[model samples]
Target: MNQPASLPLAESLLAAPLPAGGPAWLDAARREHRAAFAAGGLPDTRIEAWKYTALRGLAQRRFADGDAAAAARGVDVAAFALPGVEGPRLVFVNGVFRADLSALEALPAGVSLQPLSQALRGDAEPLRFALSRPALVGHGREAGDAFAQINAARAADGVVLRVAAHAKSIAPVRLVFVGAAADAELAWHARNVIELGEGAELDLVEQHVSLGEQAQLATLVSDIELGDHARLRHVVVQDAAAGANLIRRSGLRLHARAQATLHVLELGGALVRHDLRAELVGDGAQFHTRGVFMPHGRQHIDTQLAIRHQALDTTSSSHWRGVAGDRARGVFRGAIVVAPGADGSDANLSNKNLLLSPAAEIDTKPELEIYADEVKAAHGATVGQLDERSLFYLRSRGIPLGEARALLTAAFCRAMLDDLPNAVLREHLSGLLIAQLPA
Candidate 1:
């Protein structure tokens, strides 16, 4: 697969010098990634995971590896608001660490929020344990997908959050990824790692947005591990330029008695593909997923998710909803696998999408593979227009047609936002949704 010539620029720019001076082991791993990414530039439909999203459009574009850092000047954090909650916030501008822009004051006991550049010098064991795990991208030694390979080789700064044993954070920890490089050709490779110690509790919010018209490419990876009895709530929102391209992957590991709830919200972006994967490695582990997306115009969004139950007594639940209008395209593919020894595993997955325009498109796939007959697993998917009955009911009340349509769409996403468990945060995100919705 010949990458569009514009990509080599990104390759060269991201391949630049490393902050830690590049360790031998890390460089070797990156070399492997480079080989893998080179082997598979843009996957075709034959690949099961990327069947719907033919990467042809992106492959043809002279995707810019941007160099517009100076243009990122004069950013107003006030103008980029999510509406509801107040808590400790860390801000990143154009993938560069902006510690000065962060509002981090007091951290809970047993919690350390250090940048990767800093962590590399402190501890080796935790870093190895987190990076040694299998990637959700690799299909085999050739590494399943080239995207992960490319990101691993070029990624720059990232946040390393460690929650020590028996610790808890009451307020949500928010990380804001803001992209506004005026140079207009910057490429950002962002990586984040989170480690939860035994019996820890945490709430996290990951936000992404671009402030300018720069042609940018963002590849992000989040690696996370949960210790025994740990609990985590994570929410992610991706909003960027209408021409921005993003490839993001998140991998998770759960130990016994650990639990997690994840919310994915895709409100904006020209092209967005998110790969979310999780594994339950301990008995009594639980996973929950809820997602919402409202795409309009020429926007394109795809979400691929999977949960693996390798231990007994694991439970998983997922529900996702989306609305596509104008020429927008949306997709959701979800899978649940129960291994042989994963007895007593219970899993349920459902995906629902609405095509608001005749030209808009949505493709959804939900799969369940249970090797253990004793395990219970089910999956379902639906793609349809607005409910006729509901629309009629709303119209009969003398409400305007456009307002009624927006109301119905909001109702669908409301359930997911309500799952946040934090009243302040949920309400805050809800307002953001309301602002994004068409009035």
Candidate 2:
């Protein structure tokens, strides 16, 4: 197959100068992954993973490499900031870190937060060790998809968080990636690495948003490692302009007695896809995930999740909800895998979606692969519209027909929105959904 013109930009950008000098091993890894991405090109509908969401729009857009030194005047910092959560905050504009727009709180004794580019230049061994881990059983590659590899090969800037053993953080860390309006289409790639030491705990939030109507493409990759008895609560919110294309991939590994909880809110974008994978490699490891994707108008959103139990007595649970209105489309797939000898493992997965318009569409698939006899695993999916009885009940209470429908729709999504650990964010998302609900 002939490569798209926009695809060539990835190779060109990979050959560009590195943001900072890294170890020899890290440099070699980047070159190899870049080559692999060049060979694979862009994924199309033929690929099982991308069967529903096509990449034609991404291929047709002419995206230039994001300029790291772009002025910060294009973004409004105050308007986008979270309401109540106060702590250290990092801001990135078009994938480049902006110290001028960031604020740092007094760090706890054992936590270190720095930019990935800066950490690489400082010759951090933890980063090298984390990236050196295997993507699959024998592959030591740091990425699972072509877009993830492109991010690793041409990343401009991102966050690197490290917590010392037994350290606990009371304040949450926030990372904001803002897309700037530009005359020419632009592509921005960033990779974030987070490591939590044994017995440590941290709360992290990531948000992606756009400032104007500029056509932009954003690719992000996050790699996380949790040590024994560690806990991490993560939340992701993506709200991009209608002319933007967004792709995000997250890979996580948990150790014995470690726990990871994730909540995602997908509310805005012209086209968006988020892939999340968690591997429990230690006995008693736990993973919990929940997300909500509400797409309206002609927008499209896809959410994919895979949880693997590789150790005895591990546990995994995942649930997601989606709402599609107008001519929009929503897709969800949840897969749970229990490896051989993973005895006593328990896993559950479910996906639910609602369609408010006849023209709107939704596709959902839940899968389970159990290789261990002693393990327990189940998966299911549901797609339907609002219950007529519930709508009628609301109307009988003196609410107008449109208002009744809106209230029921909002209530349906509010169930998942309430899972957010951050109270301020939950309130904000509730208001956003209420304002966007169709009458």
Which portions of model 1 miss their true places by more than 4 Å?
1-20, 62-72, 121-125, 132-144
Q: On residues 391-426, what C-alpha lDDT tens digit does candidate 2 reach at each position?
A: 889888899988888888888878876767678878
Any idea what lDDT model 2 has?
0.80
lDDT of model 2 at residue 371?
90
- RMSD (CA, Å), candidate 1 to true, equals 2.8
Residues 192-234 of candidate 1: C-alpha lDDT, one tens digit per residue: 8898999999888888888767567778888899999999999
Listed in order, each prediction's TM-score against the native is 0.91, 0.93
lDDT per model vs. reference: 0.77, 0.80
**Candidate 2 Cα RMSD after full superposition onto the native fold (Å):** 2.6
Residue 308 shift from truth in candidate 2, angstroms = 0.3
- Best by TM-score, which number? 2
